[model samples]
Target: MLRTLLKSVSELSTKIDKLIFLCQRSAMGVIDRRTEEMDSDAIHFPLRTHEELRSLEAALDNKKYRDHFVARLRNLMCDDTRKSAKACLQYILSPELANIYTLHGTRSKFGISKYKFYSTVQSALCSHFRSASCPEKEILHAMATASQAFLHDARNKVHKRGWRSKERLASQALSDVTNIINDTSTST
Candidate 1:
C-alpha cells in the first residue's frame, strides 16, 4: 500500500510540473502580445527633422512599414549576423523590458543581469533560427550603437527646436516693449 501511494504521488508531481510549465509559457505569450501592441505605438528611433518625423508618421500609418523596415534591416546584415541581430532587436524593443529598465533605472530587476538577458536572447535565437554563430558581444555592441544614435539624434533635434522657439518668443516680447514705448512717447 505504501509503494502504491508513493507511485501515485510521483505521478501527481509530474502532472503539477507540467501544468506549471504550461502556465509559464502562456504567461510569456501574453507578455509578447502586449509588447507587440506597445511597439506599434512607440517609435523606436529619433526623428532628426520635421520632414523625417512626417515621413516616419506616414510610414507608420501604413501597416506594412514594420515588415518592410525589418526586411531592409535584415538585408543589411551579413548571413551570420542576421539571425542574432534580429533576435536581439526583438528583445531590445520589448516594451515590458524597456519600461522595467527605464522606470526602474536598473537592469538587475527580477534577478536578471545583462549577461543573463544576453544569454536568453542568444538561446532564443539559436532555437528559433538553428544558428549560433553570432556572439553575444556583437549583439551587445549593436544594441549599444543603436541606442546611442537614437539618443544623440533626439537630443540634437530637441535643442535646435527649443532654441529656435525661445528666440522667436524673445524677439516678439522685445518688439511688443518697443511698440509700447513708442506709443507712450508720441502721446506724451
Candidate 2:
C-alpha cells in the first residue's frame, strides 16, 4: 500500500519537474524559431506515425527516448517567434486529425492519465504508418474511427440490452411513419 502511494507521488513529482522544465525553456529564448536552427542536433526524431510512436515507446520502455522527445517538444514549445509547437500540439491532439509526427513522444510512454484510449490510438497510428507510404489522411481517418469506437465502447457499457431493443422498436416506428407519408404522397 505504501509502495503504491510512493510510486504515485514520484510520478507526480516527475511530471511536475517536466512541466517546470518546459516553462523554464519557454522563458529562456531557446525555443525561438528565428534564433534556433532547424537542423540542430538538439532535436530528436520526428513522431508522425504510430510506428514512429511505437519506436519511441520502445525507446521509452528502455528509458532511451524520454530525454530526446522531451528536449524536442520543449524546444518546439519554447519557440516564441512562431506558432510551431502550439500548432503542432493542436493538430496532434485534434480528434479529426492525427499529428503523427508529434503527438506520441515515444512508444511505451503514456500520458498524464496513462489512458489506454490514447495508447490504442498510438498503436493504430503506428500500424497505419507502417503499412502505408502516404498516411496523412489515413491517420486522421483512423483517429476519427478509433475515437468513435472508444466512445461507442464506453457508451455501450452504460446502455442495457433493453435500451437497444427499445431503440430498434423506435426505428421501426419511424420507418412506418415514413412509409405512410410516402403512400399518401403517391396517392395524391
Candidate 3:
C-alpha cells in the first residue's frame, strides 16, 4: 500500500512540474509578443522628408565623419561639455535608440529633419544634464557625433548578419515544434 502511495505521489509531482513549466512558457510568450509589437510600432514611425532620409544615410555611410565627431566628443575638456557628451553618448547607446533607426536600413524615419533631430536631442541632453556652461552648438555636435557612431555600428551589424532577436528566435522555435508535431502525427 505504501509503495502504491509513493508511486502516485511521484506521478502527481511530475504532472505538477509539467503544468508549471507550461504556464511559465505561456506567460513568456505573451511578454515576447507585446515587446515585438512595440518594436514594430517604433520601426514603422514615418519620416518627414526625403532630405531627412538622405541625411541619415550619409551619416551612416561616412566613417570619417563619424570618427571626427567621436574625436571631438573625446576631446571635450569643459565640465559642462563633458556632462553633455556623457548624456548624448548614453542616449545613443541605449536600446531605446533603436527607434531612431529604421529596420529597412541605415535610414531613419524619425519624422524630423536632421537639424530638428539634433535640436531635439540637444534639448533632451540639456534637460537631463543641466549643463549651463556648455555651448548649445557643442551639445548639438556631440549628439550628432554619437548618433553617427551608433548608426555606423548598426550598419556594420547588418553587414555582419548579427544574431537574431529574441522574437525571431521564439517564432522560429514555435514553427519548428509545429512541424515536428505534424510530422509525428502523420507518421503514426
Candidate 4:
C-alpha cells in the first residue's frame, strides 16, 4: 500500500509540473503580446517631427535626455578633425542608396541635390534644425551649436517641412538603414 501511495504521489507531481510549465508559457505569451502592442502603438500612431520636437522640448526643458544628447553633440561637433556634416551627406548621392528608397509608400523627401553648403557654425548647426530634412549627423551636429537660433528655430518651427531622407530618419523606413547611414563609419 505504501508503494502504491508513492506511485500516486509521483504522478500528481508530474501533472503539477506540466501545469506549471503551461502557466509559465502562457505568461510569457502575454508579455510578448504586450510588447508587440506597445511597439505597434508607436507605429500606427508614429511620432512625427512635431511630436518628437515636442517630446524633445519637454525633455530638454526638464533636463532629461538632453544631458546625454547634449554632451554627445558637444564632443562630436567640437572635433573639427572629423569630416564636415555636408560631406557626410554625400552618401545621399550614392548610386546604391540614392536609386533605392525605403520611405513609406508616400512621403516627401529632401531633394538631395538641392542641399546648400552651410556657412558658419550657426548655419551648419541649424541647417536641418526644425525642418528635420537632414541626416542624423546633421541632427547631432545641430545640437552642438547650443545656439539660440538652433533652439529658436526648432521651438518656433521656422523651417517646418516634410521629413525627407526617411530612409535615414526612420528605422522602419529602410531595410538597409544601418548600412546606408553608417556607410561612412568604416572609413573613419
Candidate 5:
C-alpha cells in the first residue's frame, strides 16, 4: 500500500516538473514563434498493424477542435512555428500517443490513450495558453456515449449528419438515448 502511494507521488512530482519546463518554453513563444527545434532524440513508439492505424487515423483526421485552440496547443508544446496541425493530427492518430514525443524536457512517459491525452494535459496547458479550450464536461461524456452507440447502431439518430458542432451533436445523442429509454419503459 505504501509503495503504491510513493509511486503515485513520484509520478505527480515528475509531471509537475515537466509542466514547469513547458511554461518556460511558452514564455519564449511570446517573443518569437517558438521555432526552436525540440530535441530529435524523442523516444519512438512501436508500430501497429495497418488496419489498426487506419481506423485511428480516420478518427483523428475527423477531430474538430476549434482551429485557434489547436494552434495554441501546438505553440505551447514545442517547435511551435515549425509543427503543423496536420502533423500533430497525424502524430495523435497513431497508437503511440502515450509513448510518443513527450514534452520538450524530462523523459517522463504518458500512459493515457489518444482519446484521453488531451483531457489529462488540458488544465495545465490551458493555464499557460489562454486560447486553449476543450468541449464542456457534459459534452465530453455525451461524445463517449455517442462513440459507443456508433459501434452499436451506425444508423442511429446520433450518426445523422447535421450542422451542429461535435459537442452539440454529442450532447443531443445523450438526450436521444434518454428519450429512447423512456419510450421503451413506458411502452412496456
Candidate 6:
C-alpha cells in the first residue's frame, strides 16, 4: 500500500512540475511580447540641421543610432524582467495554496498524511533543483532567471522552512488531487 502511495506521489510530482513549466513559459511569452513592442516603438530621429547634418551624417555612420537603440532595448528588457518577476512573486504568495491543501483531507485518514506528502514533494522539488540535468531544470532555470530581479524581496516569503520551491508546493497539491481521483476510481 505504501509503495503504491509512493508511486502515486511520484506521478503527481511529475504532473505538477509540468504545470509549473507551463506557467513559466507563459511568463516568458509576456517578456518576449514586451521586447517586440519596444522594437516596434523605436524613436525616429528628426533631420538635424540640413547642411551640417549632411556632412555629419556622412562621417557619423549608424553607430550613434545603433547605440541608442541598444540602450533602449536593454531598458525594455529590464522592465520586462521586473514585470515577470512581480507576477511570479504574486503567484508564490497567493492563498490558493490552501485550496490545494484541502484536497488532501481524506489522505489524513490513511497513513499517507499531509505532512508526509508535503515532505515527499519537498524532496522531489529540491532534488530537481539541485540536479540541473533533470528534464524540469530548463523550466526551473527560466523561472529563476526571470525572477532574479525580485529574489532579494521574494526569497524569504515564497516558502517556509519545509519546502523551498513552488514546484514542491504544486506537487503536494497534485498528490492530493491524484489520491482523490484514485479513491473515486476504486469506489466505482
Query: Clashing residue pairs in candidate 3, if any?
Result: none
Q: Write the per-residue lDDT of candidate 6 for residues 134-174, one digit (tens) a residue.
A: 44555344445443433334334444434345677799899
Better of 1 and 3 by lDDT: 3
Q: What does candidate 4's lDDT look like per residue over 103-159, in tens digits?
A: 111254322222221122234344434354555565554433322232233323323
Candidate 1 per-residue lDDT over residues 129-166, each given as its tens digit: 35366455665555455444433443354455453445
Q: At residue 61, give the lDDT of candidate 4.
A: 33
Q: Each model's C-alpha lDDT?
A: 0.45, 0.43, 0.48, 0.36, 0.39, 0.39
Which residue ranges in model 4 land beyond 4 Å of their true spot? 1-48, 81-188
* TM-scores, one per candidate: 0.26, 0.24, 0.35, 0.22, 0.21, 0.20
User: Which one wins on TM-score?
Assistant: 3
**How would the candidate models be sorted by TM-score, starting from the highest?**
3, 1, 2, 4, 5, 6
Model 4: how far residue 12 lies from native, Å: 61
Which ten-residue region of model 4 has the weakest summed lDDT? 37-46
Superposed Cα deviation of residue 79, candidate 6 (Å): 18
Please report the TM-score between candidate 6 and the true structure: 0.20
lDDT tens per residue, model 5, 1-188: 99999999999999999987566544423212355333212212122233333233222332342233344345545422122222333343332222232332235542222433334234323333343253345334433343333222322223354335456779999999999999999999
Question: Residue 68's C-alpha lDDT in candidate 1?
Answer: 48
TM-score of candidate 4 versus the correct structure, residues matched by position:
0.22
- Considering only N, C-alpha and C atoms within 3 Å, which residue pairs clash in candidate 4? none
Stretches off by above 4 angstroms in model 2 are: 1-45, 79-188
